[model samples]
Target: MADQLYLSLWFPNFRFEALPAALVSVLRQFALVSGEKRVTAASVYPISFTESPVYQRIYVNDDRAQSTEDSIIENAVAEATEQLHDDMAYEFEMKWNLWMPEGNDTPISEAALDTLWRPHPSTVKILGFGPHFDQATYEQNGHIRVDFGLDTPWVMDEEQEEVLDEEAQKHVQQNVEMLLAFTLSVEKNCGISSRLLWTESGEPLAEKLIARLQRLN
Candidate 1:
């Protein structure tokens, strides 16, 4: 089954006052890896995730023209973290392209499988936690968390009982490489003390990917 994926990052001796800079660094790393320089939106949630955002800004609105400065990683982070507090969370959304299968009800033939998958833009969320937000959830979720949404792009339709052909394997491998590169970049560039890539189902993603690749071999 496909599961939600997340990357948790912890910084050494992190201080609450440095969250905005940390958030900007992480977002900049994301832009470098994903090639999507502009943050689409940003939100500041007070107390917990259950509460409505105290501050929200959508840069991609159709009614407003986005200025060059408006999308800058530093500017977006500054805007969202302007009302920074120990009981709030800051979230930024950005786009990253990944190979995904087009929606089709019919079973795809091996020869047509390659044509069904294409590089599509996916929204990824990078959130920085305040010390007291969500009851100090950062102690477990890390100081910063990246929500990559679904794990489908990495493993492909595992439940379908379909074997990946060479072309299909190529696309899947590319997606995995992109993910690894991004993870490495974030760790290397963001001054992260430790990082973890996890799934909502509590299953290790590496094991599933290894199994899938073993089948391909």
Candidate 2:
């Protein structure tokens, strides 16, 4: 797996003015720890990796979670709107950096993957394996598309097959399923218009996100 998987969210109908308060309300519900200085605020949430506190992260294990959070973001958008048909969007992102050691293919169990990945029954609708690419400069091309639900086995790849057995593959599949479910959950909750897009880059995140948003529009 790569060193990190980046997930970005944007509202196709929200403006920049909807932030701070909107973000604060949504973060509070998820029990995030935030630090604000003047106009800048940083929020942190602790997420479990393999049942241990490897590093900070977050997750949603239920479907209603999306609806609940969506309401908060939507309300913020409504308040920030000046007209009846304002078409601004909120652009945000989340990244999952590999906290655990890379070369440790300890063959996770299927049951465990199920618990970690599948947060809801409807999440089972995910497909495995996204479109393959061989370009060396793909990550920096800036043409990346966010295709979470359509991809099958989104987590595992050929490298995993080289290390894991059939059983392990199955477990990884579940993990991918859970990833899909979780992605959907965030999309619903955060009220994002586009799917989660990923890439590896040395450029600023804000610049990358703005470019992607232009493409979507």
Candidate 3:
């Protein structure tokens, strides 16, 4: 069994957005709501495809998410998958950071959010040049990485904890469900398609994962 799971959500018609700028906007909005007087900011870098023409990361130190935190990962994944199956069916990788600011910014509209992200023509060329963006050549030529991390409190010691034990098994199952849900939400909100790839090479676990997610629907 793999300890960590890797999933990708790629946007086919996704016009690449300047995520750093958008993140800055998001954080600024957060500050406004929290009543923090200091100017909020983020560290933007191109962790992937840096040498290339595109920049893809907007790093932040804040512990808060852009939306409600309860089962957020799950909701995002489920919603995203439903949206994808309903619309474009192409495969995708998830690398972007998504956060919905907290406030009564509701009537703001997606159009208003569009101002934060600018389209990059170079990324369009790079993505469209390949048949599937997940292919080896595309990954090499446009080597940009999107980073997302899942944090939980259920920690165990290798010397004492047996993974197959009932409690341990339950924790593992919860993580898997959260990953799937997060992927779905990304697709739903971002207009992207996603696929989950296991870091550990094996067929049985992968099959089991697919089965579980399918059963979820």
Local accuracy by lDDT, each model: 0.82, 0.32, 0.30
| lDDT (Cα, 0-100) at 60 in candidate 2 | 35
TM-score of 3: 0.35
Model 2, CA-based lDDT: 0.32
Across 16-85, the per-residue lDDT of candidate 1 in tens digits comes to 9999999888888888888889899999999999999989888863456645678788888887887779
Q: Estimated TM-score per prediction?
A: 0.87, 0.35, 0.35
Worst 10 residues of 1 by lDDT: 104-113
Q: Write the per-residue lDDT of candidate 2 for residues 1-217, one digit (tens) a residue.
A: 2223444444555444444443433333222211111111111211211233212212332463454332343333333232221122222222221111122332222223223332121111111111122232122321122222222233333444445454445444454434544555555675556654454532343344344334323
Task: Give me the displacement of residue 1 in model 2, in angstroms.
Answer: 6.5
lDDT of 3 at 11: 40
lDDT tens readout by residue for model 3, 1-217: 2143333334444332332222223223323332332321112112222224231222222466453432222232233233221111111122322222123232112213222322111100001112233333223222222222221111223322332344333433454554455445444554434443433333334465656445434
In candidate 1, position 99 carries an lDDT of 69
Best by TM-score: 1
